[model samples]
Target: MTVALWCILIAIFLPYLCTGVAKVSGGYRLKDNHDPRGFLDSLEGLGKRANAAQLNSFEVTPAFAAAVIVAHLAGNAELVTINVLSVLFITSRLLYIIFYLADLATLRSLMWFVGMGLIVSFFVVSV
Candidate 1:
């Protein structure tokens, strides 16, 4: 698939990765309860951050996917623009996860902003 399409695939699965970390941390505890709030409340530090990242990933995915589709339909087919934003969004999200797990709030917030900017920039390129 094209880079843009691959990005859509990545967007689809990123949340799962974050959740996996959370679950792996919780182990049998989460496996038993499996209640969203309970499982989330049980986490601390890096696990909590993983859960937050999972939620945030869910929140951001739709717009990012939509933007990819829009840019695809816009017929510019400017793979360079699409690919750059794709990489930026993915990289920022990875860094966001790392920073969040490390409890570096400031850097995490910056990465969040950068991810948002990259998301917004996709719309810009679509136009």
Candidate 2:
């Protein structure tokens, strides 16, 4: 449960971190409606990606939480690996968001792979 709570915390803050980065990069104001096409388009894309990242976090977090819970119930020590991997997944996801916003497609893909690998690895180890 504690691990799950930490994962949730990371999930909640990851998108906000991306949003803050976008603002710093002059992407767009959170509430601004007056921007040029280029800025608006970029900002919209950033917002969408941020939202997508949040949704992805939600998608994986439950599987992570369930894995941990099952491990606990089964008295398995493998949950420790899953917990660590969950943290790694969250960190890699944040990196993915930054790379995505910077338009580093290859790096973003690599980071995404790392995150996905962690999630899949967790499931494999949990079972």
Candidate 3:
């Protein structure tokens, strides 16, 4: 499969990664109550950050999916271009999560910008 498509797969899985982090950070257990919202609300520090990362991932996923679909439909964007931009976005997102969990606000912001730029690039390249 194309890397861009793989990116979609990665995007789908990213939220689960965040959830896993949140669970561990918040001391969640299998038998615990499933009041996720409550649990997250009570979280602080890394736990809070993990929940935020999950939320952010969900927020950005639609735009990223739309951009990739547009690029596919345009049929003009080069495969290498699509792959590189896809990798860039996913890499940035991974960095975003790491930076956020580590409380590196500046780095997280930078990765956010980079990921957004790559999303925009998909549209621009399609044009």
Candidate 4:
């Protein structure tokens, strides 16, 4: 398999990774029953970020897959570059989720932009 395929696989597993993080953190139980709201809120926050990462992965993976197939079909020499970008994009998105869950808005947004830029670049190059 190509690097792009590996990156896609990693992206596919990102949501599971987020869930693992949540389980390790608290297993969905917040605190006392009196403060159930707080626990639920924290879980909600993590779930939102995990959903965001999954959405990003969904957005980029298809394009990366297409690029990989097309590159192989057309004998394009830039497949490695595209695959590298795919890896970088997924890695940045994983970090983005962690930072987002930690409430690091600026850094998360920056990482988001980087990931989106990679997707856009892939689309542009593929066309």
Candidate 5:
């Protein structure tokens, strides 16, 4: 598969990665499985930040996926361009998560904008 397509797959699972971090760090147990949302909601500090990042990841993933797919189907942009943007988006997300965990709100917000801009770039490149 193309790198951009692979990025779509990665984007789909990124939220799970964030949630996993939250669960592992939040002291989530088997009992918590019955009320996972509640357990997640109770998290504080890094766990809470991770959970928030997970939610944000889920929120942006669809648009990122759609942008990549639309870019591919349009077949107007160079493959390298699409792949680079996809990689950059993933990088931005990773940085965003790191910043969130570190409680660096400004940097995290900047990375979020970067990711969104990359998503928009995909559509622009397809045009």
Candidate 6:
């Protein structure tokens, strides 16, 4: 599969990674599984930011995946271009999560914008 396709898979699972961080850091217990959302809602600081990042990850993943898929199907853009944008999007998301956990709101927002721009670039390149 293409690198951009692999990135779609990564995007799908990225939220789980963030949630794992929140759960592990927030003192997750087996019993908490019964109320996972509540457990996450109770988290603070790093845990809270991680949970928020997870949610944002979920929110953006569909668009990113769609952009990659559409770009591939459209066959209008160079494979290397699509792959580079996909990699950059994933990198931006990783940095976004880091910035969020570190409470760097400005940097986190900047990363968010960069990821979104990468998503849009996929579509623009396809056309």
C-alpha lDDT (0 to 100) for residue 76 of candidate 1: 70
lDDT of 5: 0.94
Tens-place lDDT per residue, model 5, 1-127, is 9998999899899999999999999988888799999999999999999999999999999999999999999999999999999999999999999999899999999999999999999999999
Expressed as tens digits, the lDDT of each residue in 1-127 for candidate 6 is 9999999999999999999999999999998899999999999989999999999999999999999999999999999999999999999999999999999999999999999999999999999
Model 5, poorest ten-residue lDDT window?
Answer: 26-35
Candidate 1's residue-wise lDDT over 1-127, tens digit each? Answer: 6787798889889888988888777663535665766777688877788899999989988888888888878877488889888878888888988888788999999999998888788777767
Q: By lDDT, is 5 or 6 better? A: 6
Among all windows of 10 consecutive residues in model 6, the one with the lowest summed lDDT is 27-36
TM-score of model 5 vs. true structure:
0.97
Q: Please provide TM-scores, in order, for all candidate models, with all chains considered together.
A: 0.88, 0.63, 0.96, 0.66, 0.97, 0.98
Task: For candidate 4, write residues 44-119 as lDDT tens digits.
Answer: 5666555455455556666656655665565544787777777887788778887877878899889878887876
Residue 112, model 5: lDDT of 95
Cα-based lDDT at residue 27, candidate 4: 58
Ranking by TM-score: 6, 5, 3, 1, 4, 2
Q: Rate the local accuracy (lDDT) of all candidates.
A: 0.83, 0.63, 0.91, 0.67, 0.94, 0.96
Better of 4 and 6 by TM-score: 6
Give candidate 2's TM-score: 0.63
Best by lDDT: 6
Q: Which stretches of candidate 4 lie over 4 Å from their true place?
A: 28-77
Candidate 3, residue 86: the lDDT equals 89
The alpha-carbon deviation from the true structure for residue 101 of candidate 6, after best TM-score superposition, in angstroms, is 0.5
Estimate candidate 1's alpha-carbon lDDT, on a 0 to 1 scale: 0.83
- Ranking 1 against 3 by lDDT, winner: 3
Q: What number of clashing residue pairs does each candidate have, in the order they appear?
A: 0, 0, 0, 0, 0, 0
Q: Per-residue error at 101 for model 1, in Å? A: 0.7
